[model samples]
Target: MLLFISYVILLLVDGTKTDETNTETDLALDKPASSSSHIIHPPQAVNDGNTGTTWGSNSCFAVQLADYDPWWQMDLQVKVKVTKVKVTARSECCPERLHDFSIDVYQEQPSNSAPKVCYFYSGSVSNPGETVTVTCSRPVTGRFVRISGKNKLNPEDVLQMCDVQVFGVAISTHFDSCASLVQYKQQHSTKTPLKTISEGIDNTAACAAACERSESCTGFSIRHLPATVCELLQGEISPSLQADVTWDSYVYQGCFSVCE
Candidate 1:
């Protein structure tokens, strides 16, 4: 009986290993990609399965300006159970810019909802053409994966990636969430704060729920810096809506009658 139990345990271990190997396919290969902004090298270059990073080789993708947060995103074309993400640093120069980057997964497009944090790398790349693999603490389910630069080294920094890859298994059934469909515009705020709640609301999700409950609420703004601030807004977006990096305004996309 002891020998039989050992054999069964061995079989189970082998089966688990085989299942993991089968699901290790790179889902982001040759997939469509978008960036906050790009200069010469387009965002598509990162997912072309090429790691070459010579100057002017077009083997990497780079953001246009040195913004506080510059991001590059990939559309898997289908929902995936993302296990890990890998990013190759540019070989030619400026590999340190990849430091303090984060990988985020979104059920909907990035503009549509806030993303869940998959992994955050706090260190800089040590070698040229070094590929950093960030394993998610747990598998994250999403169709869109984004990598954003946090600019820990400098106040403003551009993001340059030689190649980006996502490893996961695609799921057939779709994941649905009403809150995920809510649209948000970053660096934007309404002229007047319809209502401001400094306490109770801690995150964007909670702030959004407050707006949905209000009859006159058209949108809302939430900022997380000095403290969590939720501001409810009314009326349509017009010229009065000014650009403010401190706030991110969200509008209901009418996904459901209520978000909560």
Candidate 2:
């Protein structure tokens, strides 16, 4: 019947539209990303898909001059849930040079804001020319991923990378309460505990709730007086704070709002 033909055509058109919508989303997730830096040797070698082991004089390797802070970055071009980052080090020589580096993911370039530190390598890597992969604690939404730190071998902070690969897909924003703020304290603050604002709080979760509800509170340090007690802080968190204290500190993002 004519009616049946018309219904079939309508269904076919709807199906085609659905397919096109899905294709668009897929392309958005997998679109080609880009990478760049202030300086590199044999330019464009960092993310060119070529792997190199030897460093000096190799056209396939990326090397920065000793004049600036060493850094190499990958730009995903769009904000996406970053799942993992991998770095390939040059082989057969200077393996010790890769120590004391950091892998970070940022909503934008590092110049724009303080990044979420995904991983930090402080110890020496025993294997020469090995590929180091760091899986994010959770999928972090960010457009830029950077690898930076000093080249222990060079005082001027020269750096190098053979390959940098980032893998992720477009997704919603990720909140990581599990990411603890680095250890910090106020310079004049005593190592002794601040007066507890809330006693018998039960746990850090209760302490965090108090901070979230308070407008002036920037961070909270929780200690179990055998029962949890919360000490809310007024000012910013200091990373260089040296104190002999046992309680753990949880900092709110608002503490760093001024810097951003």
Candidate 3:
């Protein structure tokens, strides 16, 4: 595969450090695998015969009320400190349009009775080859999540989910979830204060999913923008657990990291 070099920029909220390493392994986008907490509903099961989106080598499954059974759930084994999560989509020609689809994040739970949804990402009307990103502002621990939705094309009704993600330091892994986001900005703002570079979902549930999917994404952010755009920035991150940078709508954990 040929990798084109693009300028990589890191913006900080305060006294935070960004990673200089570059990796392109989007393992978070790999085919869904059944875990103790999650599973994917096969294609045939959803649309009699099929429903899927293919862009180059990346294939996203269609989410419909029918077959889109798998939740892609996992166990939030430990408390994670995270920031943002970016969900990137590939270019693909489609026979239909995907719509109302949502990426739901949850706190670690034993059943769906108490499962909480982070928020639904309003996908683009024309998602030929664009990146639909979201961010979270805190560190949350959850196990089961559901990436569900459907497409609304003229002739064919389909649902599509290309990539799911989460960000944070896993209790089972060796990562860092340091101070709150506000403090990091206070001390480092001179160097890296919280500047709105991008955005994402309303809270941290989406960010958690992005972090979990990414192999190197240490953190992620879900910033709200012009009523139409949500930015999900990732890389080396800091947990935004400060007092001032708090949210009540969803899990607001200030997380930061590489764009995993």
Number of the top TM-score candidate? 1
The 10-residue segment with the lowest total lDDT in model 3:
182-191
User: lDDT tens digits, residues 208-238, model 3?
Assistant: 4444343333333343333322223333333
In order, the Cα lDDT scores of the candidates are: 0.70, 0.52, 0.37
RMSD of each: 19.0, 20.9, 18.3
**Can you tell me which runs of candidate 1 are displaced by over 4 Å?**
1-23, 174-260
Ranking by lDDT: 1, 2, 3
lDDT of 2 by residue, 37-108 (tens): 344354356666556666553523434444345566665554555666677676776555566777777886
Error of 2 at 220 (Å): 49
For each candidate, what TM-score against the reference? 0.57, 0.47, 0.40
The digit string of per-residue lDDT tens for model 1 on 1-260 reads 00110001111011112354565556788888998888788899998877687546788887866555689999886566788888998887888767888899988899998888899888788788788999997788788999988864554467878988888655422112322323344556646877999999898879876765554465677888789999887655334455676777665433322111
**Candidate 3 regions with alpha-carbon error over 4 angstroms:** 1-19, 22-58, 63-82, 95-98, 108-113, 123-125, 137-139, 150-155, 173-260
